[model samples]
Target: MPPLNDDAIVLRTSDFSETSMVVTFFTRESGKITCLAKGARRLKNPFDTAFDAMNVCRILYYPKSGDVLQLVTEAKLTERFRVDSTVAIYAGFHVVQLLNHFTENFSPQTALFDLTKIILNDILSLNPICRSASLEDPPEKLSRCLLHYELRLLQLVGVAPSLRECVECGEKIEVRRGARRAAFGMREGGVLCPRCRPGKTRVVSLSPEALGALQLLASPEERFWKRLQLSQKTLGEIRGVWNQYLAHQMERPVPIFQWLKR
Candidate 1:
């Protein structure tokens, strides 16, 4: 087939042979693709692209027949996420890893792709503003960006947790004026009201602050997230909820979670 061009974020790269590398990308036009990049292992490769994780580039590749990996002929580095902090860099890794694992090959996820790109840029931009300050404090911008990206990704993929209603009994969650804390059923895929919380397994309790922040994160209005802020305790609660839901959905451990939790 003819060479296809698209903007992509490098997800993972591994040496295929002495002089070639297999590079996986989550692209804007194509969801996720693995391509064999010839001479990619050389000091000065022909593709002229760095296949490092979290790097965004414009790629030109020839699709192979059947199940064969595509051949990437040209990859030009369009953007590199340069962040000084290890926390920032790891946050970016977590974003790309989520995109890599949640998406399917050749399936177009334009909205998710766009969200991933923007979140990466947001994580990168944090370094300049917080250069001297520590991110260990409450109201962490990095945590907010990560949370927003993960929430949007699940929504785009159609597995977003049912926050508005109880998963077990189909009751409205009354998020605005209900109990101070609520139960979230991991397997049931939504919040569980007190009436339906009996004998439930794999559930986590969410504070009112956490639930409100999650609603804002999952809001259709983008400005809600931009103005949203969370305390360290609330961020921890939300992250726990995300971990449980993602674990239930993905059915395996996401390696980046280790670094992200730290």
Candidate 2:
């Protein structure tokens, strides 16, 4: 059969032999593919720096049957990630790590692939002046970028937390005026209305401010992140709730969250 051609981002790589390497890529046409790039480690190989993590490249590979690895024929670098800011670079890695975790091989995820590219571009465009030394107290722009990417990735993966209605009773939630707190059920899966709040052992209370910020983060509006302003206390609340929710969904702690939160 003819080789399949598509755009892909390098997700991982490991040495296979003295002159070859095994690579995992998230492709635009194919969701995730692990392939052997013969001689990729050589000085003059079919793939050059295209295998570097987070780099985007155009790849040609021959697909295999079940449980068999694909064979990469040719690859050319199309884009390389900027290394100006440590915060931005870590954010990019967070994006790639989630993509690696949420996707399955041989499945097509074109929309997710496009979203990844957009988020990477946004991270790359951050001003050096707006960046910090680490993920702790990240600049507003970088924070927004990461939050948007996390929310969108949840949506794409079909596990987005429900913020509008009670996950238990399916009732629409209405926050009363001067309401200070709301309930979220991590295992039961999202915000819980007052009527459904009783007798739940796993529910956690969230600040109304943090809840509102979450709703905005989940919005489809392209510029919603920019318009939403969150105070430090509220940001911490949101991050805490979000991290717990993620841990519940994945059944384990996300390693990147440590670096991101620190």
Candidate with top TM-score is 2
Relative to the true structure, candidate 2 reaches a TM of 0.93
TM-score for candidate 1: 0.92
Model 2 poorest ten-residue lDDT run:
127-136
Number of clashes recorded per candidate = 0, 0
Off by over 4 Å in 2: 175-177
Give per-model TM-scores: 0.92, 0.93
Model 1: lDDT to the true structure: 0.82
Alpha-carbon error at 117 in model 1, in Å? Answer: 0.8
Top-lDDT structure, candidate number:
2
| Model 1 agreement with the true structure over 1-262: per-residue lDDT tens digits | 7899999999999989999999999989878899999988988877664688888999999987666799998888888877887667667778887888888888998888788888888887887654555435412777777788888889999899988788877888765655658899898888998999999898888877789899898865679997887777778878877886887899998766754442
In candidate 2, residue 62 scores what lDDT? 95
